[model samples]
Target: MPIASEPGPGAAPAGADPVPQFSEWRKGVAGVLAKVRRVEIAELPDEPEHLLDETTYDGLTVAPLYTRRDELPEHPLPGAFPFVRGGDATRDVHRGWYVSAHFAGPDAAEVNREILAALGNGVSAVWLGAGERGVPVADLPAALSGLLFDLAPLALDAGAATAEAAERVYAALDGYDTASRKDIQVCLGAAPLTSRFADAANIGLAETVTLAAGAVARAETVCAITVDGTAFHNAGASDAQELGASIAAGLAYLRALTERLDIAAALGQLTFRFAATDDQFATVAKFRAARRLWARVAHVCGAPDFGGAPQHAVTSAAMMTQRDPWVNLLRTTLAAFGAGVGGADAVTVLPFDSALPAGELGVSKSFADRMARNTQLLLLEESHLGFVQDPAAGSWYVEELTDALAAKAWEFMQEIEAEGGYSAALDSGLLAERVAATRAARDTDVAHRKTSVTGVNEFPNLAEPPLSEQARRADRIARYGATFEALRNRSDTYLAEHGARPKALLVPLGSVAEHNVRVTFIANLLASGGIESVNPGPLTVDTIAAAATEAGAPIAVLCGSDKRYGAEAGAAVEQLRAAGVETVLLAGAAKAVAELEDAQRPDGFLAAKIDAVAALSGLLEKVGA
Candidate 1:
């Protein structure tokens, strides 16, 4: 028989009242409250079901509570054959991950200066962007002039010109130490599949293959292939879709290269990059799950002992908002925490103003770049987040999420493989179709305020100045808050052209006690679209009409409790319509009002359940904004 552990300080004496478990506690509370309020806690405004149950896009259900019983699969130790916990038994041996940041300049000499500055600070690696916005092919020698090869690793993203860039880098490093060339870390970043959606040409496959073969022949440690998920992620692919697509792309490379090289050699020449989002736990699970799934793929490919996957995490650009870019610092901090704890080999935090275009290749402000680099330093030196390996290994929520995500991602990868692999899926439009569907659902949530985008969709700054138009470098990158930004932009245009901002009159019905809640709600909602709400407090029907006319606002929305709306909405609407109000809307849903006369019906409603983006757009047009 198993022994029962003795309870400590909080335990009740031997049989005083039995402590209630979660199930019993739930049932006992349900017995005391009415059926409607049972969904909510006694004093808290939130619904228990909403708080506890979450459904991911892959159809995985996250339980509110987890326990030992929820632990199903057993994970192996770190450095084991599967390498789920990372390939190294000792995680913190290298002092921490490589603090990396991207650099882009018109000329190689200018880039060289930025590189030196970055290294002199906290950055340990250089992520060089190559192409029209970065160093040109002819300037490679001058670009890498002052770099110490052994001290800092180099990862080059040359886009369509990866082959030429590789040759240039090779020539640049000609006089460096030959032994250091063998041991120094470098990634050529040849990504052909990623270029398909990134609007760049595909000149990498043949050249990368040739480079890989040469590297093997010369006994050089160089990553010739890069499987990047940021393109798909920024294009709005769900977590499973991103992982599946990345794995499928990796498999495609493995299949294409194995004809010329061994499986281990091909694996050694590859690296993978993933996006880290502000959702810290989800980001952690995503990285952990990606490693586990890739290991399984490697096992199937007959390279079970090929070591762990090399992950380079970049903070999600889709999560960055143009408004209140300062909030991005906190967002990147959380993402970095996830990346560090998730065991990324290298992590890059994009500057907070990444959404705002500074120039070609998205040049960041000097201060912004400093903040981005220092964020990693703080995580490593101050927070000590890098001291532990697989920090979430024992947590029930993370473990469960990791397992579920891995299973879903594995299934998705198999589906892609059955469809003739990554390239074929992209050509057949299946990949884009899947991503489009998920993007639509995500956009719907954002429009309905189901997904809160702080400083954009939620707590917007009505008076904040708009950012100047930016020349985007790539076509595939998607911004989730761009739609809301467009609405606010329209208001700015209206204000600038007419010298007066668009205004909405909040026609509140009934007493202050009945209308205050929705009055505040309507004001905030209008502010999100850069439209000011003119609230004259709780007013009588006649006075509300006069106020609406005096405000000269084309849009009027009724704000009050359902009971008050059902009682006085008809009279208020008739008066407002008589006062020349062109459009009338209600703050609450029509269904919430128990009874309504024909005159009480609004032209439309502006509730939380409606498509807020579309509704706001319509309202702006109605107000001639």
Candidate 2:
């Protein structure tokens, strides 16, 4: 699986000119970088804008960039002393990544319908959004039978509060024949240990992973329990806390799974799920570090032979805003790019309107998915990002950052171990206490302007648009939860509605404007055809700034070619009060749009595709804001 070596029996192996051709020190296995030949960085030293930092999380220093690689001890390659890249082999998946779509609705039939839709459309895996108490797929067989994609779509996640509930869910999935249906695929998640767990509903989460591994294929089901970093982030977990606590959670799962299934199965079945938002580089670096640490953990557990662990990434919920739901597509696109580049085996880009009410929104829902998928298409077919593996493998900053992440996570893991292992640490409230402390710090930083959320803290939601969505899932949940008598007894009252303002502007950035031009025309067409319409003048620093400042409506249809975007645009939107806009979109396909977004910057990056439009409209209709 190692990407067939050079033409000849290793014809001088292409790429980064053999180190011996330039340096002598790097010739040995795991040789410490004696010299790296420092060169000028267009982004570092002289750059006015700052990307790295020395901030702290719960008093722990959060590495801004990576640490000096030469300063750290070295580990062997995959299957060697460290196994960082992966285990022996078999991990080098042909190309692209496993696909996925999440289902969270209360209705069994409706959620099943979504599963079928995704499968037919090309999703290889799924994450069932069971409530705190799981709804077993076994409880609903009709839903699973509609698959149009591959057979036995992986049954990885079935969330429930207790072991009993999780078992029921798995029992339902295990009903399928893996040989014939391959439905045995699965990973049941345990709810996160929240700040109020001791008194609240703390159930057997590790029990679920252990139980699933014991019953299911030892090779499949990810043995790791998700930290639900996004769940914590949504509840206000700080960056470092999200990172630290997740690392701790991962370690806990490794130890626990190893206990139940042994180190071999624990390492083989273990995988990590992360949330990627608009923080492009951070998202990338986070995964890189995660892979590094996971390998180390396997080694530390005496399972040094375990290869690459699966890393599945989903977009962040905390970052998705219900107000400007259309922008979510753009946000997720960059997140997807970060995950894919960071080496995730699977990536799920949520519909932008996810934060919104639900189905009540406009059809903009499809737009989000289309853009997400098409963005990958662009990266693979046009950008050739997938042609090579670990494109960022040798970046000085990336490598150093990866090392730093590994070190930090390892440090935190040690701290957790000191607290009597992850589970004991959780039981003692260490994880929650640490996260709480970090959350407070992050809030302070945001409030004090040490950190900025473009459209949130700084750019307040100034102009409130009319009702754009209704409680979509809430309604569905009600439908499912409501019995005949309950429905009959429930109050039925309706109120009059108001109208949302209509206006659209196309702002395209970059020197090569072909893609954006098409997107602009599409945006204009969508607007004229019924949606609001406006075209910002050709993308220029002055024009973008002027339009951003003077724009009246909550939605600004911003467009820019990949080449045109960077800190300039980021700077322009850096101060654009988060309050003013509902949607800050990049008017083009995902390929171009993903490059346009920087969570630290101003605009939503996405193409004006019909699905993207539908997805945005879905949010608007759902929230009715």
Candidate 3:
């Protein structure tokens, strides 16, 4: 939502300035919070100030409120030098972004049918998935049959076989009219460094550059070298890291190609692809920052007049979850919106179930592809997101984020350059090391619920049907929630083989009011790891021990208020141990159970602060769940 610059009704006089009014508003908020804490105004929440502060992943602080003071100094207009706002000064408001739909089926005929249907619906571009899994080079003629290449831009990702793939595409275009052939636009996804990073063979950077120079000479619209950051992004690189890697890779390509072609021609032969996630502000800022950074690169290379880097945004595969695949629609929608608002020339939203490794039937696959196309259509047509030039242009938050991201990314790019550029950094394992550190930090956050994935680690649907083994593809990219999903899957396997998940007896050691909160917390926590909690109502130590013995559960967990835990936990542990409970877990912190002697403490603790993945894995192994 756009921030309101005008003062609200009735508070300030007509024609009064907004700056002082905004300052007065801040004071009013403080005054109201003071009144609420003092109980003068019982309707307001106490400590409302806490609601206004937030921290971003990069450690950037976001204020609840922003004023004109937060705005950056004036920059060049859209399509101007630097092109921070956008590539075109007019910003293609009338055309909107291209809705690129990917066709990855192996059968060329099926891919052709899918592409035609996609274009007839809402897709503006055809993205042929390149590789053995996609349309083979020999099948390009069949895939391109009956397509009007001039009308829709064609983009393909062939991985290491990019040169051969590009040739196949060009050969297939022989069917198009000579006049229309010159107008066709194709983004040749040929990034050698990206292939090398993924450990794929047949990466030919020089050959790809050679092909790009030829394609540019033949057709002005064909981009020969696509600097893709999807591999780095899927590997869990931070936003700055992804940008840095992409820019450095692009520069490397520019340096190599310029030896044979002019700087401007070399620059025009490049296209950049970045992953767009559900973090709307960050995605938007990353794309915008990319343009600014590229402009600087071009300027340094004596090609300042070259246009801004054209960007293609693909909705993040890393963010897609296989468990509750429907949630991916929302994720893609937000990503598409961010990409459009951030001035991406095109955006591709992957199907909701794309994260699954199994093959989908034609009917189901078509449905998913249609949904992906419609997401971009809805954003551009109904939402009209692309009608405005740099919709985030004047917002203080976006501007600040853009600048900060650019600075961080620029630093990373410089570091890579200092180490002899992108190829050198990747070869030396510096890029991988950086991405690994970020991934570790991110995984820890997801494990502890600091970052929540709706249907995976948090609020999981325990009743959901099991995914069939045939439908489970082993080749799917790893996601942040993979570890948690593994735990759940193991429990599912155990249940199928043995008829039940291991049960945990929850001993709530106080009255319902005293123990209900912790009981619920512990139950949900255990459920996250597929451990069923058996609650026979709140009970005393003797009753709890009798119930545990009757239930025959190998594990027992105590749940109660800190005061109750301190008073009764030691006795409860002794009773549970006497009843032959193999392991005892406390719902709260160990220090919370003050009355428990060092020898009387439970086997382990399950609290909000602990590493949830480790705790749950340990519990599952102990109970054979």
Candidate 4:
């Protein structure tokens, strides 16, 4: 496997199309090609290698151990210079974070019911996921009277508001007169460059932040201008890139608003949102790194203290796979755990049944909001992960990765600095290219088997039923937000442009049956998509038997799961071939497929326990039809 060649100690990658010139550098200075030494000896118990221990979000090759004592590019202190450890020595251990869940039903009464239920179930804040324009309080006083506990129902959007509408939202809530106004928060969803491509919207997120921060007396209440890191995460940003972009966004808003309201006061209301994906360490490292990164930016921006602002994290909708739906809970757990460990002020996990709604056109499904909300409560109370701080703190690998990420991100930031900064980089399409390249590389690795995801790429059951919308991206308000700068105002258009995608005929072979032919099946499947295959006929066993006989073989092909492909499976292959058939293929692996091969050799055989995609791709090649 996976090997770590002493990471880039000097120049660029060796095979970079046209190599960098290194004719006049010091010996071992810019052209050192350190030999990769895996084992001083592999049989030793003390030196067993772990493949995952050395990988990183940026694809950097890190050693098994790195530390503060290790040679690192030096930086300044926390809250003083570069702000690596953190900013201002203070950290939040306050009754640990609000569980903010978004809720929207058919109307106010229906919506109020969800809000009240959430408050009852421990959701401290409520985000009214896009499409509702006013403070959802129709008869606000009555709604408050009914609730045992008070809740903040926040609205979201990305556009300028008329003078009247803004006043109406404030008045509607004021008229409600709930004692919990002390805890109630309102956010004007005006995030900057949230939609850079939209030329006409007078939506200045910084302006809205200033307006609300200046007016509100509920010092605890937020007039938040969200900087969603999820947008960049889903678009394939490495943990460092995601953190840098978020820092820049927060700074952009802070630089604009500190002129009006004090910087700390404005930042206090800002919510930095991120997406928690399946890669737990990366997710954990992301939030912690984000905190450290933001702390630095805040210090540079002249804030005396740079901690305590809320970090809102949502489990990524992108990482949820449609193929083993139940495995989604495991994925969500890993991601949510990362968010919690990395110090999220709040975390939300999307239900296994979210995509059906987030992807709907015109009729957004509300299937998972309640489930998503409950996920946080389940973790907060059940898992009890709240009992620690920077949990992975000093572990050699984590620390190394953390420092490595900071340095790599700083390098990118320096380049941006040379080009006038983050906004300029985004405008020039540099950001998109960077994230896209990472995504393509990862996707290619997954497809090729270079990176094996257990239930996904490696051991997959071809006979298993295809998955539906049981799991999906937590519902995102599509195509708007600074993260959507490249995609805004054109989601539907882009979808239209790439319309009518590839169609695959998924053959669901019930648990196991003799009718199944694993290799030919996959090869045929692959062939339908324009790959080549080595079979013909009605995709039936009788036809396969006939072909075997014609090929002058005394064995036939039989394919099915272990349950069906027992010892008799070989016997049946022989019986069919005696009647003029020639090979047997078992979709199930393990000793069963091998046992059949040991019993007697068929002309050719291929078997798989999982991997419908690869199998199908292979099968498609065998039979053109």
Best model number under TM-score:
1
Worst 10 residues of 3 by lDDT: 1-10
Q: What digit string (tens of lDDT, one per residue) describes model 4 on residues 1-625? A: 0123454555346555223332232223212322233333333333232332565557566664343334344333333333333333343433344577755443656667767777776777655533234333343333333443234445354245422334445555655646655566566555555344223243565466556565445533645576777767677677777776676666667766776777767666566788887778777767767666666666666774744456778887766644334566777778887787766766777776454334432223344555566566676677666555556765656666666676676666666556666677678887767777777666555544455444444443233332223222334332111111111112223223444212222112234344345645554433222222333333333344455445442222445455555544555555554664323344344566465565553344444324334543443333222
Q: How would you encode candidate 2's per-residue C-alpha lDDT over 162-250 as one tens digit per residue? A: 34544554445555444533323454445444322323344465555656465445333434344455555554554444556666666
- Residue 57 lDDT, candidate 2, scale 0-100: 50
- TM-score per candidate, in order? 0.91, 0.59, 0.90, 0.64
**Model 4 bad stretches (over 4 Å):** 1-53, 62-95, 132-169, 176-183, 195-202, 205-220, 358-371, 452-625
What order do you get sorting by lDDT, best first? 3, 1, 4, 2
lDDT of each candidate versus the true structure: 0.80, 0.52, 0.81, 0.52
- Which residue segments of model 1 deviate by more than 4 Å? 1-20, 28-51, 72-74, 90-94, 178-181, 359-364, 471-475, 592-594
Candidate 3 residue lDDT tens string, 1-625: 1223544354446655535767567657867776656754345555455556787655566677777656566567778768778887754576688888888878889888888888889888888876674888888878988888888889887776777888788787764676756668888877787778867654587788788778877753788877888888888888899898889988898889988999998999888899999999899999999998999999889888795878999999999886777888999999998888888888999999887744442337667777888888888888888788788987888998898888888999999999999989988999999888988888999889788887877777667666667544454354877777777887787788888887899998889999898888888777778778899998997697799898899999999888888778898998999999999989888788755687679998888877888888888898776
Candidate 1: pairs in clash: none
Ranking by TM-score: 1, 3, 4, 2
**Global lDDT for candidate 3?**
0.81
Deviation from native of the Cα of residue 91 in model 3, angstroms: 5.3
Q: Which stretches of candidate 3 lie over 4 Å from their true place?
A: 1-57, 90-94, 178-182, 359-363, 468-478, 598-600
- How far off is model 1, as Cα RMSD? 4.8
TM-score, model 1 to reference: 0.91
Question: What are the clash counts of all predictions, listed in order?
Answer: 0, 61, 1, 32
